[model samples]
Target chain A: MTALLEVSGIEKSFGGIRALNGCSLTVERGMIHGLIGPNGSGKTTLFNVLTGYENPDAGEVRLDGVVITGIGPGKVFRLGIGRTFQLTRVFIRLSVLDNMLIAAQHQHKWLRSALRSPGQGGERAKAMELLDFVGIARLAELEAGALSYGQRKLLELAYLLMADPDVLLLDEPAGGVNPTLINQLADKIKELNSAGKTILVVEHNMEFVMGICGRITVMHQGRALLTDVPAAVRSDPRVLDAYLGGAEDEGLEAEAVRTEGGSK
Target chain B: MAILSAKAKPISKGKAAVVVAAIAVIAVFPLVFTNPAVTEIAIFALMFMATSEAWNGFAGWSGYFSLGHAVFFGVGAYTFAIIANDYKLPAGSGLFLLMPVAGVVAMVAAVLVGAVALRTKRHTFVVITIGVFFIFQLLGYNLSITAGASGLQVPTPYNWNAATFNNPFYYAAAILLGFTVGLYWIIRRSAFGLQLLAIRDDEERAKGLGVPVWRVKLSAFVISSFPVGMAGALFAFLIGQIYPNTVFNPLFDLSWALMTLVGGIGTIAGPLLGGVVLESVQQYLNLYLSNADIYLIVYGVVFLAVMFWMPRGVVPTVGDALRRRRGAGEATIAATNNGGTDSSSEGKATGSLAGVVQEGGK
Candidate 1:
C-alpha cells in the first residue's frame, strides 16, 4: 500500500543541539506505526514537525501526496493531521463533553453562525458518543481537569477522534498510564487502525509499542536507524545496541519478557 | 419558543424570574425618578456595564489582557465629535445617526489593531494595544480639528427639557447595555465562543483542534469595539464635550478590566454584576469623599481583597460554594435514600479528583 504520510530528509536543530537530522519515515495507510527511541531520540521533535508545531530547517512532509510543510499547526490540523502532546494538553477548565465539542469541525461561515447556539445540531450527542467510545461518558459532566492522568490521556485520544482525522500523531500515549489502561489504549489503537485510520505513535513503553504497532521505526540520535516489522525490529542488533547505549534497555528487556511470558 | 430554543443551556427558573423582575424595575425607573444625580449615576452605570461587557468579550473570555481598549472608546468619541462639527443637519435625529457611524469607525480600527496586535503573544499583545492607545491619545492632542488639549464642545442640537433630555440618553445607554449583554450571551453559546474558550484554556491545544485562533480572537475584538465605541459616542453627547485626557483615559480601560474581574472574569453575568456594584460604590464614594483620589485607594484595596479571597471573582466563587453545599445536601439525601452506600461513591469521585486537579495544574 502507498504511504499515507511521508516525511523525508527532515533536519531541525535547536541552538547547538540537533533535534532531528536527516530523519525520514513513511506511515502506510490503515496501519499502527510506532516510532521507538530512547530519551532525546527526537521522536517527539519529529511529531512536532509533522504536525506543524515546528518547521524543519530542511525537509518535506506530505500527507496523502499533498505538501503540508510549514502550514502552521491549525492549518495542518484542518488538512487532517491530528496530534496529542506528550504532556497531554487539554482544556482543563472545560467539561469533558465541551472539550470534545470544541474539537468537532465548525463548517459554518464564520460570521453567519457565530450567534447560533453552540449546543445545537447534535454536536453534543456526537461528543458524548466519543466520550463513551473512550469509556469516559460517565465523567463527561466533570471538568477535564478532574480526570485521572490515564483518563486525560484517553480523553486526549478521544478528542482526536472527534475530528476523525486521516492520520493521528499520539505522543507517548502509554506514558504514566496504568497497565490495565495501557492495554485498553492499545486495544483502542488497534480498533481505530482496523477501522482504516492511520496512526503514528511515539512511545517509550516497549511492550505496548511492540504489541500494537505492525511496523516499527527505530530512531536513534535524531535519525531513523531502521524501519521494519515489529518482530524484525525487536530482534535487530542495531536496535538492541541503540537501546542498550541509550539507557532504555530495561524497557527493551521488558518487551521481550512480556512477549515470551504472555500470548503475544 | 425562539428564546427558549436559542439558549445554549437551560436557565434555572429562579434566575429567570429574578431577571424578569429586574428588567421590569429598570424599565420604569426613569418614569418615577427625576433627580439628575440619580439619573446621571444610572446612565454611568449602564454605560460602564456596556463597556465592561464589551471588554470582557475578548479579554476576559479568551484570557487576552488588553490594557488599551480605551483606544476604541477615544476613537468613538472623536468620530462623533468630528462628524457633529463637520455636519449641519436636523436637530434630534442627527446625533442618533452618528452612533452607528462611530461604532463602524471603532470596529474598523479594531480590525486594524487586532490584525497587528493579535499576531503577538498575549503579553506582547497588551503592550502593543497600549502603544496603539498612546498613539491615538497623541493624535487626539495634536490634531487641529480635535481642538487640541482644550477639547471640543458639542452643541445641543435639540431643545430638550430636563426629563426629556435625560430620558433619551438614559434609554439609549440602557438599550446599548442590553444589546451588548445580549450579544455576549449569544456569543457565549455560539461555536466561535467555544473556540475562544478553548483558546483561553489552552491556545496550542485549541490550534491543534483546528480553531483559527487569531481570526476568532480578532472577531471578538472587533465585536467588542462596537458597543464600547457606541458607549463612548453616547457619553460624549451626554457630557456635551470630548477631551483626549477624559474620553481616552487609561482609567476607562482599567475600569473595564476591574468590573469584569469583580463580577467573575469569564462568566456571562460577571461584568454586569461587577459594573453595577463597582459603579454604585464609586458613586457613593464620590458623594461621601471630597477628595477623589482616596476612592482610587479604596479601589486598590478592594481589588487586592478580591484577589486574595476570591481569585475566581465574586460570581464564580459564590457559585462554587453554593454548588458544593447543594452537592453535600444531595449526598445527604442520597445517603438516606440508599442507606449510606452513596457516601463511598461520592467520596470515590471527589477523592480521586483532588489528586487530578493538582496534577492537571502542572
Candidate 2:
C-alpha cells in the first residue's frame, strides 16, 4: 500500500541560497513523525512545501498515492492536512470559539456555507471538544488575542483539530513554551497519535521530539540526512554534526533571518 | 461552545429600543418635515449611508480597501440609463423600476472587475482599482453610448415640480439605506462575515487556518457592489440626468470611504452613523456656502481629526468609553483584541497589508 504521505526530491530556493533541496520522506499511517534539524536545515521549509505554503521548485508530494503538489494552502487544508505555525497564529480579534468555526467553514461552498450558521449543534460541540482536547476549552468564550502565549499555542492546536485533518504539521510546538505546557503538549500529541491521526512535528527541543514521535527524520542543509527510530536518530553522528559543527547555526539571530526569508 | 461569536453580539434591549425609535423618527421624517429642501438633505444622507455601508462590507471587513467602488456606483447609474433608453421606458416609476437591474449589472461588473483586481497584492490592488476608476472615468468622457461629455438627460417624472417631488426619491433612498444596513448586519453575523473579519486581521494567518481568502474577498466585493450600484441608480433617478463626471465622481468614492472610516469600519452602525452625519454636514455646508471647494477643506480637516483623535472611529471609541465608565477590566477581551485590530485596520484604510506575509506560494 502507498504510504500515507510521500515526498521525493523537493527543491526550493530564495535569492542565492537553497532552503529545501532534494528533500524526501514518507510518513506511514498513524505515525508520530518527528522532523528535527539544525538552523537553516529546511525543516520549516519542508513543512511549508508539504502543506503548499511554498510551492516546491522540483518535487512530487502524494497523499495516499494521489499527487498533491502546489494545490495551494486552502485546497491542501480542505484535503485534510492541517498545519500550525511556530509563533502561534490565531485571530486575535475573533472570539476563541469562532476561530474553530472559521476552520470548519473554509472549504464549504461560500454561498451556502456562509449563509448557514456553522456555529450550531454538532460543529459547536466538536469545536468545544477540540478545545477541550487541547486544554483551552475554558478559554473558548474569550477573544483569541487575549490568550496567554502558551494558551494561544493550545488554542492554535485546538482550531487545527476542529478541521479533523488526517495529518497534522506542527512547527515548533514546544518552542518558547514552559516545561509544564511542553509536557502537556507532548501528552496531547501522543494521545492524538494513538487515536488514529498522523502527525509530523518540527521542533528544536530534542526531548520533546524524541519523547513522543515514533520515528524521526534528521535534515541538514536543506536535505533529509536520515529517517530512523528515535533511538537510532539519537546516536547518529551526522545529526550531532548538523546541530554543532556549523558555527552560524549556534546563534538564534542567523536562523531567524533565514527563517523569515525562507519560510515566507 | 457558546463563546461570543460575531453572531453572539445581540442588540441589547436598550440598544434595540433606540434602534426602533430611530427608525420611527426616520420613517416620519419626510412627513413631519414636508419641505423638499429638508427632505433633500435626508435623502442624500440616506444615499451616502447606503453607499458607505456598501464600501464597508468588502473594504472594511475583508481588508481589500477599494478606492474605486465608484466604478460600481457609476456602472449602476449607466446601466439604468442605458437600459431605460433601450427599452424606451417612461419618465415615472417605469424608469425607477429598472434600479434592481442596474444593481445586478453592477454586481456582474464587480465580479469581473474584482476578479482581476483582487489578484494583485494589497498595495498593488489599490493602484489597480484607482487605475480602473480612471479608465471608467475616461470611458465616460469618450464612449458614444454614454453620449460623450454631452451627458444624458433622463425624462422628468410627473412629480418633478410637485410638492412631493423629493418624497419618492426620499423614501426610495431610505429603503435602499435600510436594505444595505440590514444585509450587512446579516452578513456580519454570518459565517462568511466571520471569515472576512479573519481576513482583515491577518490574511496569511487566516489562509493558513484554511480560509479561501481570494474567493471570500471577491464574494464580499460583489455583494457590496449590488447596493452601491442600486444607490447609484437611485441617485441617477434623483438627478434626472447622468454624466460620467456626475455618476463616476472620485469624490463619491473618497467621501464614502471617509464616512465609513470616521464611523468605525467593520461595525454595522459605524458606517450608518458616519455616513449620515458627514453627508448632512456636507449638504448643509453646500447650502450655506457660495463655493463647493470650502467644504472639501472641511472634509480634509475631518479626515485629519478622525485620523488623530478617533482613529478607531466614533462608534468604537464611544463604546470603549462607555465600557470603561462601567468599570470594565483594563484587560477585558474587547480591549485586548481591539488593540491589535485597531492598528492593522487603520493601515487597511489606505490599502496596506502590513500584517499579511504568508501568500507568496501562489
Candidate 3:
C-alpha cells in the first residue's frame, strides 16, 4: 500500500532547544497508527509540523505523494489532512451545531459561505448527522464550551470528520477521558478505520493504543525508535525501557489500574 | 430541564417588542423633530450606528480589534470628495454611483493592510492597524490629490434646489441605517458569521478544524470596510466638504468603538442600540454643557463602566439574567407539579447550557 502520509527527516528547534530532531515516520492508507512517547519527546511538535502549524527547519511532509512542507495550516487542511489538538479547541460561545457547521463549510468558497445563511441549505442536516454520529445530537444547541471533556473530544472528532479528510491526525484522543469513554473512543476509531479512513493517533494510553491501533511507532528524544505491529512493539525491550524510565510509567500504571478494575 | 415558566417567554417577547418599538420610534424621529439641529444629531446617530456596526463585525465577532477602521471611512470620504470635486463628477449622477468606487478603494486598502497586519495577533495586530491609520492620515494630509490639509469641498448640486440637499441628507442616513441593519441580519445568520465567532473564541482550533482563518478574517475586513466607505461617501456629500483632520478624527473613531462596546460588542443589534442612545446623550450634553467637554468625559466613564459591569454588553447580559430567573421559576413550577421529588437533581442538570439549548430550540 502506498503511504498516505510521509514525513522524512523533519527537524525543528526553538532557539537552543531541539523540539524535533530528524524525526521520520510513514503511515499507509486505512490503518490506525499510534505515536507514543514521554512528554517533551516531540509528539505534539510532530503533529504541528505535519499540519503546517510550524515549519520544520529541515524536512518534507508529503500527503498522497505531494510535498506539503512549509505550507500554512489552512492550506494543509485543504490538502485533505485534518487534526485535533491535545487540549480541545472549540468555539466556546457558539452552539455545538454551529461549531460543526463552520467546519463543514470548508468545502465552499469563503464568499459563497459568507453570503449564505447560517445553518441554511443542506449544512444543518449534515451538521446534525455528524453530531448524532458523535452521540452529541442532544447537545446540538448547547454552547461547545459547556461540554464534558469526553464529549468535547467526540465533538472535535466530529468537527474533523466534517472536512471528510483522507488522513485524520488525532493528538491524544483518550488523554483525559474516562475509561468507559476510552472504550467508546476505541470503538469509534475502529469504526472510522473500517470505513477506510487513515488515522494517525498520538496516544499515551497503552491499552487504548494496544486495543485500537494496528501499528505503533515509538518516539524517543524526538526520533522514532521503532515502528511495528502492536504486539511486537509491546514486547520490544527498548520500548519498555523508554516507558519505565520516562513519564510513560505513570500512564502504564493508569492502564494497569483500569485493567485491574475491569477484571473485578 | 427547567419547567416552562411564563417569565422566560415574556422576557424574550418583550425584548423583541422593545427593539421593534425603538426602530419605529427612530423611523419617525426625523419626521417629528423637524429642527435642523436635532435632525443633524439624528444623522450623527445614524453615522455612529454605521461605523460601530462595521467595527463590531471584525473586532467584536472575529476578535480582530482594528483601530484603523477609520482608514476605510477616511478613504471613502476622500475618494468621493476627490471624484466629485477634482474630477467634477455630476451630482445628478446619484450618490449610488460613487458607492462602488469608494467601496473598492477601501477594500483594496483593507486587503493590503490586512495581508500584513493579520499575520500578527493580539496587541501586535492592534498596533499595526493604528499605525496604518496614522500613515493613511499623514498621506491624506500631504497629498494635494486629497487636497492636503485643506481637503476637498463637495459643492451642492447646482441643478437641484436646497431642499434636495437637506431632504437627501435624511434619506441618505435612512438608506445607510437600512443597509447596516440588513448587513448585520445577513451576517448574524451566515456561515461566515459562525466562522468569525469560531475564530474569535479560538483561532488555532478554528484553523485546525479546516477554517481558512486568514481568509475568513480578510473577507470580514473587506466586507466591513465597504459600509465604512459608503458612510464616508455619504458624509462627504452631506457635509459638502472634508478636511484630513475632520475626516480622520480619532475622537470620532473612539466614539464608534465605545458605542459598539457599550451596545454589546458581538451582537447584531447592540451597536445600533448603543449608537442611538449614546449619540442622543452626547447631543443633550453638548446642549447643556457648552465648553465643559463633559460629554467626552461622560462617554469615557460610561465605556469604562460598561467594560467593568457588562463586558459582554447590555443585550447578552440582560438576556442571560432574565433567562436565569425564568429558568428558576420554571423549575420551581415543574417540581410542584411533579410532587417535588426530582427538584434538586433537575435543577443541577438544568444549568446554563441546558437551559439555553432548551430555550433556543423552542
Candidate 4:
C-alpha cells in the first residue's frame, strides 16, 4: 500500500544553496515520525515543500496516493495537511479564540454567512475545548500577542488542531518552550498519535524525539542519511559522522547518540 | 467548561438604541435647520461619511492602504456624467436610475485595479493605486466626453424651491451614509470580514490557514467601490455639475483615508465620526479663516495630534476605556458574589506567564 504521506525526489534551491537536494522520505499511516538534521540540512525546506509553503524546483509530493506537489500552502491545508511555523505565526492582534475560529472556518458556507450569531455559535465552545486540551484555556480571551512565547506555541498547536487535519507537520514544536511545557507538548503529541493522527515532526531535542517517535529520519546536506528505528539510528556510526562532519559538534552527536541508548 | 459572558457584542442593545435615536434626529434634521448653508454642510458631511466609510471597509480593515481611491470617485462621477450627457437624460429619476450604472463602472474598475494591486507587495500596491489614479485623472483631462477639462453640466432632476433643493440631495447623502455604515456593520460581523482581518494581521499565515487571500481582498475592494461610486453620483447631482479636476481631485481621495484615521481606522462607526468632526471643522475653518491654506495646515496639526494621542483612533480608544471600567465593575460584583474574597484577583493576575517561565526554568 502507498504510504500515508510521501516525499519523492524533491529538489529546492535558494540562490547558491540547495535547501532540499533530491530529498525523499515516506511516512506510514498512524506513525509518529521524527525528522532530524543539523543546521542547513533541509528538513524545514522539505516540510515547506510538502505543506506548499515553498515551491519545489523539481520532483513530486503525494498525500495518500494523490500527487500534490507545489499546489501552494492554502490548498495543502485544505487537503488535510496542517502545519506550524518554526517561529509562531499566531495572529497577535486577534483574541486567542478568534485565532482558532479562523482555522475552523474552512467550510464554504461559514465564510459567506452574513449574520455573526450563526457563524460563531458553536466555534467558541469548541475553541475553548481545544484550549482546555492544550492547557491554555485560561488564556482564551487574551490577545494572542500578549501570551508568552511558550503559550503562543501552544496556541499555534491548538489552532492547527482546530482545523481537524489528518496529517500534522510541526516545525520545532519544542523550540523555545520551557522544559515542563515541552514535556506536556510531547505528551499531547503521543496522545494525539494514539488517537490515530499521523505526525511528522522536525525537532532538535534528541531526548524528546527519541522518547516519543517510533521512527526517526536523519538528514544531512539536504539529503536523508538514514531512516530507522531509534535503537538502530542511535547506534548507526553514519548518523554520528554526519552530525560531526556537518557541524563539527561532537557534543550534539554524543548527546543524540548516547543519551537514550540505555533507557530504550 | 468555564462559560465566559458571551464575548462582548460588537454593539450592545442600549448603544444600538442610542444610535437609532441619533439617526432619527438626523433624518428629520433638515426641517429644524432650514438654513441653506447648514443644509449644504450636512450634504457634504454625509457624502464624505459615505466615501470615508467605503475606504475604511477595504483599506483600513485589510491594512492595504489605498492611495488612489479617487480613481473610483472620479470614474463614478464621470460615468454618471457621460451617460447623462450622451443620452440627453434629464436630471429626473432617470439620472437616479443611472447612478447604479455609475457604481457598476467604478466597481469594474476597482476589480481590474485590485487584481493587479492585490498581487504586488504592500508598498507596490500603494504605488500602483496612485499610478492608476493619476492615469484616470489624465484621461479625464484629455477625454472629449469629459468636456476637455472645462467640465460637464448636469441638469437638476427636479426643480424644487431653493429651500427644498438641498433637501433631496441632503436626504440622498444621508441615506447613502446609512447604507455605507450598514454595509460595514454586516461585513464587520461576517466571516468574510474576519478573513480580511486575518489577511491584515499576517497574510502568509492567513493563506496557510486556507483563507483565499486575494479573493477576500478583491471582494472587499469591490464592496468598497460600489458605495463610493454611488456617492460620486450623488455628489454630481448635489453640485449640479462635474469637472474632471474637481470630481477626481486627490484631496477627496486623501480625505477618505484621513477621516477614517481621525475617527478610528477599523471601527464600524469611525469613518462617519471622523467625517462629521473633521469635515465640520473644515467647513468652520473655511467659513471663518481668511486664508484657505491655513485650514489645511490646521487640519494637518489635528491629524498629527490624533496620530500621537489616539493612534488606535477615537472610537476604539474610548471604547477600550469604557470596557475596562465595565470590566472592573463586573470584577467587583463577582468578588462580592464570591463572599468578598476577590475573584478579580484571578482576572487581574498580571505576570502569570512570567511566573510560569521562572518556575519552569528551575
Candidate 5:
C-alpha cells in the first residue's frame, strides 16, 4: 500500500543534543503503526514534529502526497491530522460534552463557529456517541477534571476522535489506563483501524504495542532502527540488543505471552 | 395541539420571589430619598453598573484586564462634548450619535492594542494598556477640540423642556443600565461567551481545540468598547461638560477596576453588584471625608480587602456557597430516595474525579 504519511531525512536538534537525527519512516493507511523507544529516544519529539508542534531542522513531511511541514497545530488538524497528548491536555473546567464539542468545532468556519452555539448541529449527540465509543458515555455531563486517571485517558481519546481526523496520533493511550481498560483501548484502536482510519501510536507498553500494531518501528537515539512485522522485529539481534540489552529467550517469551494476553 | 403545551414551567419560585423583591426595593428607592443629591448618587451608581459590566465583558469574561479602558470612556466624553459643543449638534441627539462614534473609535483602539498587546503575557498586557491610556490622556489634554484643560460645556437638547432635561439624566442612566445588562445576557448565552470563559481558564488549550483565540478576544474587545463609549457620552451629557482632566480621570478608572474586581471577576452579576456597592460607599464617604485624596486612599483599602478576602469576587463566592448548600440538600434527598443507601456513589466517584482533574489542569 502507498504510504499515508512519509517523512524523509527529518532532523531536529535542541541545542547540542540531537533529538531526531536523519529519521525517516512511512506509515501506511488503515493500519495501527507503533513507534516504540526508551525514554529520551525522541519518540515524543517525533510525534511533535509530525503534528507541527515542533519544526524539524531539515526534512519533508508529506501527508497523502501533500507536504505539510512547519504548519501550526490548528492547521495540521485542519489538514486531517488529530493528536492526543501524553499528559492528557483536556479542557478541564468544561463539561465532558463541551470538551468533545470543542474538538468537533474544527469543522466549522472560525467566525461562524465562535458566534453560534456549538451545542446545535447535533454536536451533543455526536459527543455522546464518541463518549460511548470510548466507554465513558455516562460521564458526559460531569466535569472532565473529575474523571479518574484511566477515564481521563479514555476521554482524551474520545475527544480526538470527535475531530474525525484521517490520521490519529495517540502519544500513549495505554500509559495510565488499567489492564481492563488497556484491552478495551486496544479493541477501540483495532475497531478504528478496521473502519479505514490511520493510527500512529507511540507507546512504551510492549504488550499493548505488539498486539494491535500491524507494523512496529523501533527507534533508538532518534533514528529508526527497524520497521517490520512485530514477530520478525522481535527476533532481530539489533532490536533485541536495543530493547532488552541482549537478554535471552526468557525475556522474549515473557513479552510474547504478555502481548497475547493484552490482545485478548 | 397538545393541551399540556409545556405548562409554562412556572419560573422557579425562589428566583421569582427574589426578582420581585429586588424590583420593589428599586422602585421605592427614589421615594425613600427625595433629596436630589441622593438621586444623583443613585444615577451615578447605575452608570457605574454599566461601566463595570462593560469592563467585565473583556476582562472578566475573556481574562484580558484592559487597564486602558478609560480611553474609551474619555473618547466617548470628548466625542459627545465636541459633537455637541464644537460641531453645534443638538445636545441629546449629539450624545446618542457620539455613542456609536466613540464605540467605533474604541473598537479601533482595542483592535490596534489587542494586535500588539495580546501577544504579550497578562501583566505586560495590562501595563501596555495603561501606557496606551496615558498616551490618550496626554493627547486629550493637548487637543484643541477637547477644550484642552478648560473643558467644554454641553448645551441641553433644544427639544426637551426643563423637566425633561431635569429628570432626563436618571432615565438615560436607567436605559444605559438596561442596554448593558441585555448585551451581557446575549454574550453569556452565545457561544462566544463560552469560548471566552474557556480562553480565560486556559488559552493554549482553547487554541488547541481550534478556538481562534485572537478572533474571540478581538470580538469581545470590540463589544466591550461600545458600552464604555456610550457611558462616557452619557456622562458628558449628564454633567454638561467635558475636560481632559475630568474625562480621563485615573480616579474613575481605579474605582471601576476595583469595583469590578471586588464584585466578582468573571460572573455576570459581579460588576453590577460591585459597582453599585462601591459607588454608593464612595458617595457616602464623600459626605463625610470631603478630601478626594482621602477617598482614594479608602478606595485603595477597599480594593485590597476585596482582593484578600474574596479573590474570586463576591458573586462567584456566593455562587459556590449556594451550590454547596444545594449539593448537601441533594445528598440528603438522594439518601432518602435510595433508602439511606447512596447509589450515587458511582456517579459521584466518576463525577468528582472529573471535577478535580479539570480544576488541576486549569
Candidate 6:
C-alpha cells in the first residue's frame, strides 16, 4: 500500500515555545489512523500544519507525493483533506441544512454560487441524506446553534462528508459525545474507512480510538513517540509515559486557546 | 385545491398581498405628494434606502462593518461629474445616462478597495475601510480632476416643471432603490449568500468546508458598490453639484450602518426598511426642531430608544416575536440573523422528518 498523506520533519514554533518540532507521520491509503497525545503535546498543532491553517517552520507534507505547504486552509480542503475542529465550528446562525450546503459548495465558481440557492437542487437531497446518515435529519430545519454540543459534532462530520474528501482529519470525534452516539460515530467512521476514504482521528477517548483505528501514532512534546497497532502502542512504556496523567478537558481547551492565540 | 398541491415553501398569500400593497404605495408616493418638501424628504429617504441596502448586502451579511463605504459614493459622484463635464451633454438631456458609468467606476473602485480591505476581518477590516475612505476623501480634496473642495456642478433636467421639479429626482432615487432591493432579495436566497452567512458565523469553518471565503467576500463587496455608486450619482444630480466633503462624508458611512443595525443587521428587509424609517425620523425631527444641536441630540435619543426596544433591529426583533407567537420556537441567534426565512416551512420539514424517523425505526 502507498502512503496517501505523508509528513516529514515538520517544525513549527509559536514564540519561544516549539509546538511542532520535527514531527513526522504517514497514513497509508484506506487506513484508519489514530493520532493521540496529552495536552500541549502538539497533536492539534500538527493537524493545523497538515491542513494548511499554519505553515510549518520546517519540513514537508505530501499528498500522493505532491508537496502541500503554506497553501492556506481553503486550498488544503480543495486538495481533498476535510477536517472538523476540536470545538465543533459549525456556522451557528445558519440552519442545519444550510450548514451542510456550505460544505457541499463544490461548484464554487462565483456566478454559479450566486445564481443558485446554496441548496442547488441536487445538493439539497444529498445534504438531507448525509444529515440522515449522521442521525440528525430530524433537526435539519433548526439553526445549528440550537443543537446540543454532541449533535453539532455529528453535524460537523456529516457536512464534511459532503465534499467526498479523500482524507478526513477529525479532531476528537468522541470528545463530549454521549455513549450511544459515540458508538454511532465509531460505526460511521468505520463505514467511511470501508468505503475507501482514509481517516486520521485525534481523540482522548482511548477505547474508541484503539477500537476503530488500524494503526495508532502517539505524539509527545511536538514529536512522534511511536507508531504501531493499538495494542502494541497501548502496552508501550514510552507511550504510557508520554500520556502524562491522561488528557483532560481543561488541558485540551488550554491548548486550543494557546494555539488560537499563536495563530493570530 | 390548494391543499392537494405539493407547494409548501413559497411566500403565503397574505405576505404577497402585503408586498404588493407596499409596492403600490411606494409607486404612487411622489405623484400623490407633489409638494416639493414632502417629495424632497422622500427622495432623500430613497437615496438612503439604496445606499443602506447595498451596504447591508455586504457588511451586514458578511459581518464586516465598513465605515468607509462613502468612498464608493464619492467615486460614483466624481465619475458622473467628470464624464458630464468632458462629454458636453446638454442641460438635463442625459443626466441619468452617466449614472451607469458612475456605477461601473464605483465597481472598479470596489475591486481595488476590496482586494486590500477584504484580506482582514473584524475590527482591523473596519479600520482599513476607514483608512481607504479617507484616502479617497483626501484625493477629492487634492486632485485637479475633482476640482478640490470647490466641487463640480452638474446640470439638472432643464425643463422640469417648477411644481414637479422634485418628482424626476424622486423617481430616479426610487428606481435605484428598487434595483438595489431586488438585488438584495435575490442575493439573500442565493448559495453565495449562504456562503457569506457561513463566513460571518465562522471563517475557519467556512474555509475548511471549501467555501472560498476570500473570493466570495470580495464579490459581495463589489456587487454592493453598483447600487451605492448609482445612488451617489443620483444625489449629485439632485443637488446639481458635488463637493468632496459632502459626497465623501463619514456621516453617510455612519448612517448606512446605523440604519442596517436598527432595521435588522443581516436580514434582507432590514436595511431597506431601516433606511426609510430612520431617515424619516431624522428628517421629521430636523424639520420641526430647526436647531442643529437640539435635533441632533433628539435623533441620538431616538436611536438609543430604538436599540433599547429592538436590540436586534426592527425586522429580526419583530420577526422573532412573531415566530414565537406562532409556536415555531426559533428563538435563537438565527431568529435575528436569517430574518424570517425558515419559520413556517420548518413545520412541513418537521412533518417529513418525523416520517423519516419512524421509517428508520424499522
**How do all models score by TM-score?**
0.91, 0.90, 0.85, 0.90, 0.85, 0.90
| Per-residue lDDT of model 6, residues B1-362, tens digit only | 11112122355465568668978888899888888888888888989988998998889888888998999999999998888878877767368877878999999999999999988868999999999999999999999999998999886676878898888788788888888888887777778887887888788778877778888899999999998899888888888889999899988888898888777777766787888887877776666767473545655775797778766677766665665675455446444323334442222111122323422332
Worst 10 residues of 4 chain A by lDDT: A255-264
Worst 10 residues of 5 chain A by lDDT: A246-255
What's the C-alpha lDDT at position A261 in model 2? 44
Off by over 4 Å in 5: A240-264, B1-32, B92-94, B156-166, B251-253, B295-301, B304-309, B327-362
Give Cα-based local distance difference scores for all models.
Answer: 0.79, 0.80, 0.77, 0.78, 0.74, 0.80
Query: Judged by DockQ cut-offs, is candidate 4 incorrect, acceptable, medium or high?
Result: acceptable
**After superposition, which runs of candidate 6 have C-alpha atoms over 4 Å from their true positions?**
A245-264, B1-9, B291-295, B327-362
Residue-wise C-alpha lDDT for candidate 4, range A1-264, written one tens digit per residue: 238998889999999988888898899988999998777788888988999989999989999999998799988898999999887788766667778888866656544543453226677788888999999987766666578778888999998887788999899888767778889999999999988889999987888889999899998888888899999998999987877775536446564444233221
- Report candidate 6's interface RMSD in Å: 8.7
Q: Measured with DockQ on alpha carbons, how good is candidate 1?
A: 0.44
Q: What is candidate 4's CA lDDT for residue B121?
A: 77
Report the lDDT tens digits of candidate 1 across residue range B1-362. Answer: 12213324545555678678978877888888877778787888889988998999889878889988998898898888888878854457458768878999999999998888989888898899899899889989999989889998776755788655688888888889889988887787677877887888788888877777878989999999999889888988888888999888988888888888877787777788889888777876786676465657767887899888877677766655655666686865432322212211122112123434655465
What lDDT is obtained when candidate 4 is compared to the true structure?
A: 0.78
DockQ-based ranking, best first?
A: 1, 2, 6, 4, 5, 3
Minimal lDDT window, size 10, model 6 chain A:
A255-264
Backbone clashes in model 6, listed as residue pairs: A118-B191
> Which segments of model 1 are wrong by more than 4 Å?
A246-264, B1-8, B90-94, B326-361
For candidate 2, list the clashing residue pairs, or say none: none
lDDT-better candidate, 1 vs 6:
6
lDDT of 4 by residue, B24-68 (tens): 988888999999888887888888888898998998888889988
TM-scores of chain A across candidates: 0.92, 0.92, 0.93, 0.91, 0.91, 0.91
- Which of 3 and 6 is the better model by DockQ? 6
TM-score winner between 5 and 6, please give it.
6
The DockQ figures for the candidates are: 0.44, 0.40, 0.35, 0.38, 0.36, 0.39
Model 4: per-residue Cα lDDT at residue B350: 17
Model 5, range A1-264, lDDT digits (tens) per residue? 879999888899999989999999999988899997656678899988888889999998999999989977777887888888887776665667667777776688866776676567666677777888989887765656667767877888888778788999999888766788889989999999998899999977787889999899988778898899988876788876765663223344454455445432
Residue A193 C-alpha lDDT in model 4:
90
Top candidate, metric DockQ: 1
